[model samples]
Target: MKAFPQQPTYTGFNEPSRVEADVCDLEVEGELPLDLNGTYYRVGPDPQYAPRLGSDIYFNGDGMVSMFRFKNGRVDLKSRYVRTDKFKLEQEAGHALFGAYRNPWSDDPAVQGKNRGTANTNIVFHNGQLLALKEDSPPVAMDPDTLETIGNWDFNGKLSSQTFTAHPKIDPQTGEMVCFGYSATGVDTPDIAYYVVGPTGEIVHEVWIKSPYNCMIHDFGVTRDFVIFPIVPVVSSAERAKAGRPTFGWDGTKDIYLGVMPRRGTARDVRWFRAPNQFASHVMNAFNEGSKVHIDMPRAESNMFPFFPDISGKPFDRERAAARVTRWTLDFNSKGDTFEARQMTSLVGDFPRIDDRYAMESYRHGYLCVSDLTKPYDALRGGSITGMFINCLGHIDLATGKHEEYFVGPTSTLQEPVFIPKSATAAEGEGYLAVLANRHEELRSDLLILDAQRLADGPIATVHLPVRLRQGLHGNWVPATAA
Candidate 1:
């Protein structure tokens, strides 16, 4: 009775796998780490039903959360769909009632005023709650042990903002979560809300500011003293939404603004630094030295998302879209409105991660999913959901300026890599990297564990999964004691 479209977004490795199962004691290719006891939680878009408009982007799918439980010397698997309002409405109707990504006008009339969040972007464990985030709405809290949807959480009704960020940074020292939301009031609004949630999961501080423009603020950075918000030109307008166009589009004419404010300061203390048009997301790490703050992230010359097309009708330039790790420096000591940016690594990739313990501090190591085009790739086997071939995992040493990589086979691509420290007090970069690899030919997936310091040595253990997980956006590792 259900037939998804045959378009590329619904075919190959991108096809929907609406499977929710609990498989105990999954098969492991190598010896599992006895001390590695925790859960790796990840969420990705997996539509529960066909789109009402006959087609939809991959990002608009329902949130499917997968967890791998590690204990003793073995691992188990459990997965479930977050019972979001959009998913519940579609389930009741036996088809999709919602129409497009962030486009409320395309939705069914009966479902007006409903929450349209997919909760498909990222998952994090904090304050004894597992939060599934989508950026467009408040976070959905799930039971960490059972993966059961508890409901939408708004900091015990203390959060007044309508939206929350997916990429929240937890301070290693204070254990506080630093996050922000753009278009906080509504779509096409320049209002941005910044919050600092204490370790007990209460919003201890809040501030509101206006962005230079209404655009996408996918991720941000936080040092001990400051919060950094980089607003690019992937903008939204009410006119575009009313006209039935995409909610957000690339605008190359506008300048990028980097707004920096004290972590505990008010909006009046915020400083806006301007830069030329560019694209950056997913903060790798950020730190400060007195009045100078440095934020590290992948920087691309133009828009990286092909789904959000150029507003000026310019074709997406793949060459300019390739991103490399770059460091942005903002000095409050200087009286200039501009910041300095310098490319740090030649390794072209995104979805960057680092030892979270070194977060908000000067760090030397980082990890990311890499696309090495010079390597062999069998495009006929399967194409990437992002339309780019991401065939490897990379590690960069900022202190030494050395780049190392572990290349997956031609028939495989990778998801974002998460770093797990070997121990609570281990030295920086002395840890294990856990990443999911999509096996195109096999139509399955594998969770790989590699030594972070020796990535070129390849996986030490591979946890095999019978089902292929469609491309996921982000995930994190939760220690057993914390979970």
Candidate 2:
């Protein structure tokens, strides 16, 4: 009899180890994949943010979330932690990821009462001054450089009582600021709808864009002439029950569509760009029905459950394979609709951020997605492998359908990848992607930097943190100039 060799057993990690990496010294740069020398910081926990009872976890600010301002070689933090108490904190600041506080005056009952939650939101730099949108009070004006509250935008009449999702898009051609609202609060009739505001912060139009579909607006991108919106149709009994509505069925074949319209166009102008069907549900990341418009989604997958399965580990067994990669370009011309698309299951991602650009243009590459396969109704109460993994940034050239893959790590749960350029004054072609890797319940998060240009290149630097970030909604990179 011969003795058999033993195989190495898999030891699950509790957190990613930063010691297993090296740093990139910025002084010697010749197209390095990722700069290892880039500095990392924790802006701190969001006190103003909290999640809804049964909805997916959200970055709501009851006051705890803080804003980290980076400059020269240092990081500065501003937060509501000291201003409000845990018992009186706001649920989620009006803005997602970007911290913009809520207006304390809106009479909407969902945001009223002692539990009337306010939130920290984002500051949009508009017309020399920064405009801060929130979940309460009035829109606060701030100095982008000093982050000082300069003034507030004035509005007449009570603002609509609805959960307004999606960032306001400006009509590059017309200059009108555009925004929309979807009501999940159960206060309004016919459910979801939209609106538009002027640059001075006056409500221009609020209209209902409804369908029998009962869908939520996911991610929306704006162009010179039109606003491109991605709508996800979901049928959740728990959601209806939670919102105090009755459960209804949606036709599975009714495809999702990208709503296209002029920046100031009427509801009639707001028509479906293609057939109401979205390319596929599996490929979308950080999505919600109409409640969440656009996310900083950098990568694509076939199905969310496959990656982050509930405790049961049974794949999206009920739904047949409905995801097929398709290329559809939408033109939201006010006069009519224009779309040029090709259906293909190959190019599987959208909204790629490139070197030193905002999410719209900065498809820099790299995506960190959390997949907890366990069902919300199932075993999470017992704890399990809520799915987590990292896919190397994918390079897509839709013009030619040419694609390339970069450093995809093994079974590690990661967060949104923020691109950090090599220099304090990093121009194009000198940026790197950074991510927070949790490595599947390695409960702590590890800060990692990867070569943006070379995906195959290993980690340039790794920073192990001392705390645990439950799940982050969204975050942005502030270079030294703004720090």
Candidate 3:
């Protein structure tokens, strides 16, 4: 029984120590309009959801929605409702916790604040219940239609301090849900691994990820009998802080390995596969093909660690480069195992799927957009075309390896694309794509829509938001038809 950290000392999730000055007011505007007709809805941070430290409170501040809006030629926001639940902030037994540490962005050494509460993953729907993964808390399940919390599973009791990234994968057949969590002592670590919450929300399955290397299971999904995950065998800041580990580069190489662990088998029975090129990156989504699997990613040239230091206003010396789309596939036959992959698309960035219309079933086919945003503050630091690019909303034909860039963007910082499917549309077969763009210089967020198929032509309508949204992590599209 590993002990867990108290609530007040945690910093990740929706709870930032303090709100940045720029996101305070929702008055910022973008280069484009905030409305699209075919898309049903676009929901993200506004006055309701932005991080709060003072007397302010969030309105529609919680929950997640579809990353893309529609299948139509002209995109617009499709109206749909989303719900999120606040995390539990209790200090577990026998753990040391503190509040008010030095602010990441402030120069004041005495500055302090409450530990940030967990910002849950874009909630997922399974067996008539909506489930979400929170950073510092447990897995919670809610109603997709009503957004009412229906269940929760605590990981704090299982490990000392744990955090979750990306959405948990759901087993479509068994009705069981799966998610990965990392636990450490303080901010740094000698961490343990655990899997929390089955799809039904009653079981807290403790997962043991075996590796000679340090295992950090980030984003993953589940198939009939195996839990597919991309593991980064590396140490974290907490581990470094405790072990006195110094920062260095490719000086020590970390391999990004894919492991297929049996759902009911022990860790020793897990079969592992390693991707050839080690890119400092995150696994967006994996397309499962029975024995074979395909992975989609935003080709990162360098380690993702360097990008973290500059998050607190520090300068990160990085090549302002764009990531390409690459696919890795593995086929496990009765005789043996085989691996094959290729560069799917170039000039593209972060991808999210709206529906099953794309060539590959994973994020690669969802919404493939292009941007020059290699680093977080690259645009804020006066780089020309920093906040620029075009967003193409449509399905990529994996067979042809060609992306029909429909909704090409001249927009700023487009976000994960969500599909609203034609079922949510009044025009029969016409569907929409909903996207978020930070057009204004001061972190103003806007909702943009496009015809899912006719995206290259441009958006039909757009909705400019009067609030700000968090810039990292992933979200999803929850259909209005869902209850």
Candidate 4:
């Protein structure tokens, strides 16, 4: 038996539930839509063994992939480990061979030169295959139906980069997956590889570019005309990794840059627009109106992850870290270096999602998990390991500038909400939201199905789970016809 650390990351609702199960006919509270068919796949960090260093961040755990299959109004769940190289090595040794998160220098000597991907960030289905992603390594392909690990996929031997982004945008019109890999050459390098994968998983186009600085480019934006990469101040360096420090840290001195390049252009055509120091991640949606491009995302004034401390030695400021939905507009006609930014909502939240059908086009209807600090919270039940209590689901109507939220009770928190269109041709925002709610007191989770148009009305159906899933980063829903 292994004993995990008693820290908050390993106790209470955050405690590791290393369970692989196949459950059928889950109890439902309300009527599930007959059209609600397909699978909701989510991947999160669930460490298989206690950390070799006796302590670890929640992001450093092993990859656990969970799939909820819906068929004929019945739901079934199947979960299994991703079986990455790191997972297999540690499983064979019966102990952890990896070290700190993204710090290869700290890994044990025996596991040197091996892939360190956790595949724990997000799971996306592309070209008939499920890709388990960690951003630092190539995608781990899995069977879409069985959820069985296939292997590390390299686009049938075309992807030369060592890394691939966990967040890949699928164009509804062209059916192409637009993705890029930062630090493409190595762990802390500035090289980024941009790829456009066709509908059949073939590499349509690949371009190599250099970032203005080495930073954590977790997510990016893509419109019909251009791809936007926000280079924030979460800086990383080779020296820091060699010194065994955290792979990334907040550098307030660096200015934020949004690199915009034509969808079919080369690296030389890339334009770097500058902005003041701030933190932004997880794009909501991006579209263009002729020469001007708009990107909506959650923006904060400072670092959000406390584990990645400030490089300047400044203590993390919780107030400044509250992220709000903000829209940034960049004009190609203007010669200026700065873009216009406007806060779209007052809700403090991250993990934004929009209807997939209208992606890369002028559209509305966005969903996210909101952390309403004004509401009552049960601290005794404990909050997330990130030290935030996300207790609400927010619906953002960009066209009307209206924000509506549904608060889950004081004893529970919510994960990222994914939008499920009612039908293939449903109007924009005419869909349902699949959100996972963590019941802290019960030590389990419930999947809430809410009408996206009337979010405040609460869940129309709640799918209960017997086991508690660790806080997950992101997930997506695949329609039955597509799956």
Candidate 5:
């Protein structure tokens, strides 16, 4: 047996595991609402082999898709690995043949020009197909029921962009999906491709454009009339990686750029707005009013990934660079001004979400995965890295700026909460929030259901797990009818 290398990436929740399970009629702490009939799908990175380079990042791992099916007041669980080309290649080799994250030059000679993505970041369900996404490569379609890999999807050969974004937005009313790809052709390339998928899975639109610079454009926003792309300071360079430096880093000299392109037009009509340097990973929602587009999100002062340092090698202070819910208004009618931004609250958090129905329209409530102020987040590797565990779920009111939170305690960690309305006619924020919570004391995890409108009151129902699975990332509640 090959001895596995011991590294910080393999400790705690990041540790690799090979566990697939199926259980039925799980025990519940309270009542599992009968109306909450759907599947909760989540994706996480779980490396199958000890890294070939002996040092690996959390983002570099094979994807595991887990689902909880709810029906008639009962819940069933199932999980499977997303068998990507890289995963299958390593599986046959009986070890890791690839190298550093997405940099191909670091790979073993035997696996030259092999697939680079693990497809582990996020999952989306549309047109009855469950697709696993990683930004560097095209989406891999998976069997939603058995969670089996079908193959990569390129919109039946219509997608020209080699890369695809994980954060695609689905319009609630039209059922259309708005997606884009940065570095669309190759590593560190400055090209971007904006794509649209229709209600029936047709490739309705696509436009190729050049970004201000090659940067990590992770998440974007979509309103009724436009698509919003924020090109921030965090950037990647294959040339720098060939010299054994960090693949991605912050360069303070680069100005943050936001490209507002019309939903029906090409790059020629795109309006570019310049803003002060900042980093934003996610956006809650956006809407188009008369002459301006309003976008709500969490913005950070500097790069949040401690693993990737700034080019100047300046030390980072997390407390000083805290991320908060903010609003950025882009006004086209202003005589001389193009944009304005302001922090909405003092509370700090990330992974903001809203009710899907109000995604591109005016919405009142939003939720976030915030650090529990009482416990205080712990840093590892001599205060060089952070966010091994997060502790609370926060709810904010965009109209009044008042908010509340539900803490899971010091030992437990909470993933991003998925919001679903109580019913079709339910008022805004009148719904349930599904949370995947892990308790460190018993090493067990649970599915917590809380009233979205009254988050501080705590979970109304808790589904005790049959096994203690490690923490996972972004999930969604798919109604039975939709699935």
Candidate 6:
């Protein structure tokens, strides 16, 4: 077998590993907690075959699923590739057939009409089934135990939207999941579809809304009564794509649009509020204050993704872009279509995660993965595919404006930290933080289970893996009992 040439972006910490272990008994550096018993599942692009385009971006590879199963004071690691229609077709052909990252117009005619989803962005475990989710298409259902692809699921054919969201929020008050899809009808369209999935895994509600411009709305926020849709300046044009011009880019003239609507309402009820020219890819959480809405997220001055350049062919100076957690408050009582944006803290980082048990409610503390101090900020893909040498994990008190951090040193990097509660009755942040750390200098990975309440104290247990796992997008924690 010929070895695939290493793509420079895929080298270092983003390298793809073909190794799949059924059971891995990792060496623990510290004491493992007895009460922690759940599986931490993550998905990332790990292409099995070399790209036909010679070189590809980090987000263009095929989806690879990894698992860290905890049982009875022991940890077992396993991984497998998601068997998608695209993967099978490529496997049968023995080469790549897909086009550029997301421009289907660049694809070969043979696979043009086929599904373009890699299902590589996020992982979700709902109603006893695991789903590999990408924002471009319907989620591919998989067997959680064996990591085998069941098939493409469209919520029993009731999902009218062509795609689903990578970030879906499960309501704490009601066991319903609120999700939405941008460019839902087709790529480069302003169409958006909002969906609600019941606890039993059925499509409960569906509504169609359109953004003011065709933009990549990757993530949104959900309050008890409302859903917040943030439409930034990063946009796409099918005409530009067909002409071989840039498909996605930043438009400085466009102002940020926040569509605040009732969770059970339609597009006509959506009240659009305009904010400054700020861009945020992810939202932490949102809540209602009667006629007012508060949405919290990390805001950057401009589009941080340099790979997807502006249509003008001008370079985006990533050095000018830095992310800080900010809060945008929209007041309907003011009788206007404007909002107040305020910087929450001086802490700068992405992936602001709160304890899901308190989601949609008044939450207290949250955690974030910060960039490694030793490396240049622009060295890590500007801000596109982060988590490579994001060496620090931070905890913030939402009420007290207090912050604490754990630095893994300059030798290692950490992925986004996911919070798992200790028990049903445990206090907020009285749980464990499951973070996958990559020691790129040593070419190895470790799953660090840190005490959330004692975040500054460092990991309580570290499960070391034999290979360096590529940094991924998002994942979840599924308790043993839930399965």
Residues 1-483 of candidate 3: C-alpha lDDT, one tens digit per residue: 222222221211223222322211222233322222222322332222222222222211333332333222322222222222232221221211212111122211232233332333455555555455544444555444344455553533453344554456654335465666544322333343546455545555665554434433445645454565665533344333334222112312555666666556566666777655345244445656676766665555543444223213334334533556667667644344335567766555555453533322333334555553332433443223322243344455555666666533333456666665555333322466666665534445566656776777666556555434443335555454433
lDDT of 4: 0.90
The count of backbone overlaps in candidate 4 is: 0
Each prediction's Cα lDDT score? Answer: 0.90, 0.40, 0.44, 0.90, 0.83, 0.83
In angstroms, give how far residue 15 of model 5 lies from its true place. Answer: 1.7
Tens-digit lDDT track for model 1 on 202-240?
999999999988999999989999999999999997888
Local error of candidate 5 at 186, Å? 0.6
Candidate 3 lDDT at 309 equals 35
Write model 2 residue lDDT over 327-412, tens digit each, in one string: 45543333444454454324333323344342223222333232222313222332233333334455443334555555434444
Off by over 4 Å in 5: 1-4, 333-337, 376-389
Alpha carbon lDDT at 185, candidate 3: 29
TM-score of each: 0.98, 0.58, 0.63, 0.98, 0.95, 0.95
Distance from true position, residue 122, model 1, in Å? 0.6
- What range of 10 consecutive residues in model 6 has the weakest lDDT sum? 379-388
Candidate 4 deviant stretches above 4 angstroms: 381-386
Residues 1-483, candidate 6: write the lDDT tens digits. Answer: 335566566676666786667766778898888888888999888887776666767787888899888877888888888888788888887878887777888777899889978889999988888999999888999999889899898888898888889998888767788998899989899899999999999989888988999988989989998999999988988887887655778887789999989899987889999977767888888888887899999889877777777666667766445677888999755679999888877777888898988888778888888764554333333233332346688888889888888887555678888998887778888999999887766667888999997888989898888767888778888888888
Cα RMSD (angstroms) for every candidate in the order listed: 1.1, 11.1, 9.4, 1.2, 2.4, 2.7
lDDT of 5 at 147: 90
Write one digit per residue (lDDT tens) for candidate 5, span 187-262: 8999999988998898999899998887889999899988888888889888888887767888878888778877
Global fold similarity of model 3 (TM-score)? 0.63
Rank candidates, TM-score, best first. 1, 4, 5, 6, 3, 2
Model 6 segments more than 4 A misplaced: 1-5, 372-389
